[model samples]
Target: MNHASLDDFLKHGTATLAKGPVALIFVEDAVELDSTLRHHLQCGFKAVVALMPPAFELADDLEDTVHRVAFDCSHPQAVFDAVNRVIEAAPGVWLYYGYNAEYLFFPFCETRSIGEMLAFHTEERRDAMLTYVIDLYADDLENCPSAVSLERAHLDRAGYYALARPDPGNHNHPKERQLDFFGGLRWRFEEHIPAPSRRIDRIALFRAKPGLRLRSDHTFSDEEYNTYACPWHHNLTAAICSFRTAKALKANPGSTFDIDTFRWRKSVPFEWHSRQLLDLGLMEPGQWF
Candidate 1:
């Protein structure tokens, strides 16, 4: 469809999406939704929702722009109906990721447009989607040897950037020691998210290789035998570049980084992006709606 048609289609869905680009969060129990909502808003996510509303008006207040859908499998047909209800109202793209996320600390490229993301290839999908979730612990903090591989930055040409919040057990009960973040399983996302019309590329701060290594402790290591970001960790940047390179090359070439990957000894750090938050005064607390 043409640009005008796309714009008209999106206008119809504004009710559900509100001022999105949004994040579709799925939570179970004991997690307070209020803190989660505040964090998402602070992180720049447009809206947050519960996958299974806890049978309370507080969670499913749709007029407020957040949402909750019950997981009553007894009513199987209703699931499809609700999916349609949300889809019909949500415009642009839906990022089915969590507010407490790991990828946020890394480089990210937001999908430029929904139509472009739909067309990415399978090999490109992982590179474009998943995150190499890290489990950081208190004692391990002092031992933080850099996680690097291939010397080349992993690229994802079909993914969007989102945060992965850690649970108490994920880090440490007090949550003061370390954290456990998730990279949503690949197939889990086939439906919840939408495709983009054009790709966007955001480079990653982590250096990576096409392969992984397992440490003596049975943990994952990179080509260099150290902790590393999986190819997918690069997020939208890899997704976009891979897609464009594939179109030009005329076929999907597995994960497009290298037959012979290149690297820079002096790598850039991901924390640099935080300056934007500092500059805009977004780092401070403000009014919440």
Candidate 2:
């Protein structure tokens, strides 16, 4: 990393206890964000939340540092503008993030330069695994859009959770702040949030497919989504398991079928995929380390 980058990280981070904010972008419901904020805070995330088309639930968060900015849902640009507004307004008070975003920091390592990095510590091995993840998404220039984006980011691999594409996309590049050599990278660059780096059992893009224009009803966890004020939409992804069961029934209609009884790849080892994680063992904090 360059001096400027290190300076920015220290200036923007430090007290926040990590690097980068986890951003949760939702149109109406804020329940999941509420759960996630609590989860990360427990896991040591000093998070900042940004929401649009405001809801009262945001006000209920236990963290005093969480912030909210409201915008019209019809205009997605306004929502993003709200994010920029907060980050721009508070240059570096704390690591700023929206609803579900959290920070990832490399506090374990003290190597200051690339030369020092070559003497690989166990931490370096972990960073390499995360880099390989980026590479997996990048290798196929076509057919693999996520990989392509990571390749373009070219984040400093000598760190934990190197920055990837920002949430939504790289649409907002406020013209005023332009570092000549850095402009392109800054365009849609995301601040890297720390993760296990190598221990990510699963990489899920929940409800992220474009064409699956599911209604509020067809959308996963709608019942919980509707009663979010009362908090009925538990962390349980109520849709996925049922969907899997339904698919099985469609393929084999004659078998004695009960959604409750149906299970697929159930006995697999340490499964993190939705289908398998339904009964996967719980992970205590810092288990991967």
Candidate 3:
């Protein structure tokens, strides 16, 4: 069902937010919106919320399945606003958020439902799951100017690294169990990408509670929610295979002309399986066997 505005959705669409494991997909543009929604839906999310501009159209199947909200995605802090508002409305729900052309993949996701993974996480007392935004782009930008193509998607097999996330309030000491992850196209083409947006690590899958806020850096207001793992052991992590960065770099006139191709020797075809990400060490299964 389509709502005129975000407030309208919150007021009238409360039923959609009643359940846990809901996906909040913010549509930045029309590209691959349907595929992104379908992916999450197939992952067995109880509900999928599509926040997009009113001008965009949705497939008939999706129109009936997803809760559509007319939102200004271009506005600054739009993601933060929409997410936090939903968090306030749906406390105790598992919430996941991402942009168009982004796909979430957890360990054993091919056979296991996202709900199953989250269940295991909850059993371990983890309230959030760390996800790396792995950059995906078409092998050739000349034909596919937007740098997106599901059939020909390519991602860097290496170059992923993490640094200690400093705590400014505590004399710049590294935040325990937290690291600022960086890599993919953002790291390869740093000059065109802003420093703040470079980190690919995001606590994308989280349980909402009162006063929970999604920070601009993709971390959370609650410090524990931002941690990569429990102090006891490593926790399950996911990967968001995304073409958003590639699309942006190629779309932006400033960087478009400068980038001839996103492919390099390290670039490899994305197999679209959780095992590939696992083998590459992009994500971990933790103790979930």
Candidate 4:
């Protein structure tokens, strides 16, 4: 069902937000929007909320399946704003957010439903799951100028690393169980990407509660929600295989002319399986077996 605007959705369509495990997909552009939605829907989310511009068209079936909200994705803090509002309205619900061309993959996701993984996480007392935004791009940009192609998607097999996240209020000490992850196309082509936007780590899957806020940095207002794991054990992590970075880099005029292809020696074909991400150490299974 399509709502006239975000406010209209909040007022009339919020009944869809009554359940848990809702996916809030922010459509920045029309690129792979249908595939992105279908992926999350297949993950067994209770609801999939598509916050997109009214101009963008959705597949007939998707229009019937997802709760569509007209939103201006280009506005500053658009993602954070929309997500936080949903959080406020759906306290105690599981929430996940991503952009177009981004696919979420958790350990054993091929056979296990996302609900099963979140159930395990909830039992472990984890309110959020860390997800690395693994950059995906077409092997050749000449034919696929947008740098996107699900059939020919490739990602960096290496170059991913993490640094201790510092606590500014505590004499710059590293935050416990928290690290600022970086890599993928953002790190490879840093000249064109802004420093603040380089980190690929995001607490994408989370449980909403009163006063919970998604920060501009993709972290959360609640400190614990930003942690990568519990103090006792390593927690489950997920990966968002995305073409957003590659699309942006190739779309931007400054970087567009400078690159002919996104492939490098380290680039490998994305197998589109959770095991591949696990083998590459992009995500962890934690205690779930």
lDDT of 3 by residue, 1-289 (tens): 9999999999998888888899999999999999999999999999999999999999989999998999988986888988999999999999999998999999998899989999999999999999999999999988999999999999999998999999999999999999999999999999999899999998999999999988888889999999999999999999999999999999999999999999999999999999999999999999998
The residue-by-residue lDDT of candidate 1 on 1-289, one tens digit each, is 1112223424543554554445544333323355454444444554554454345334343426555444332253443333334444543333434322122322222322222332231233322232232211111112221212112223221222333323445562332211222121111222322232121212111122233322222122322221122333322222111111212111224422221221123222222243332232212111100
What are the per-residue Cα lDDT tens digits for candidate 4 across 165-256?
89999999999988999999999899999999999999999999999999899999999999988999999999999999999998899999
lDDT of 3 at 227: 92
TM-score to true structure, per model: 0.30, 0.28, 0.99, 0.98
Scanning candidate 3 in windows of ten residues, the lowest lDDT window is: 72-81
Q: Which window of ten consecutive residues has the lowest lDDT sum in model 1?
A: 239-248
The CA lDDT of each predicted structure is 0.30, 0.26, 0.94, 0.92
lDDT of 1 at 121: 19
- Tens digits of per-residue lDDT for model 2, 1-289: 1112222433553343232333333333332345444533443333434344444354354436543444343553443444333344333222212223111212121223111221222222211101011111122223332222222212212222223222223465432211111111111121221122222111111112212221321112222211111222112111011111122222343532322221122112221122222222121111122
Pairs in clash, predicted candidate 4: none
- Considering TM-score, where higher is better, how would the candidates rank from best to worst? 3, 4, 1, 2
| Top lDDT model | 3
Each model's backbone clash number? 27, 10, 0, 0
lDDT of 3: 0.94
Order of all candidates by lDDT, from best down to worst?
A: 3, 4, 1, 2
Clashes of 2: 10
Candidate 2: give the clashing pairs: 21-102, 22-101, 22-102, 23-101, 24-100, 50-98, 104-194, 137-147, 138-147, 224-233
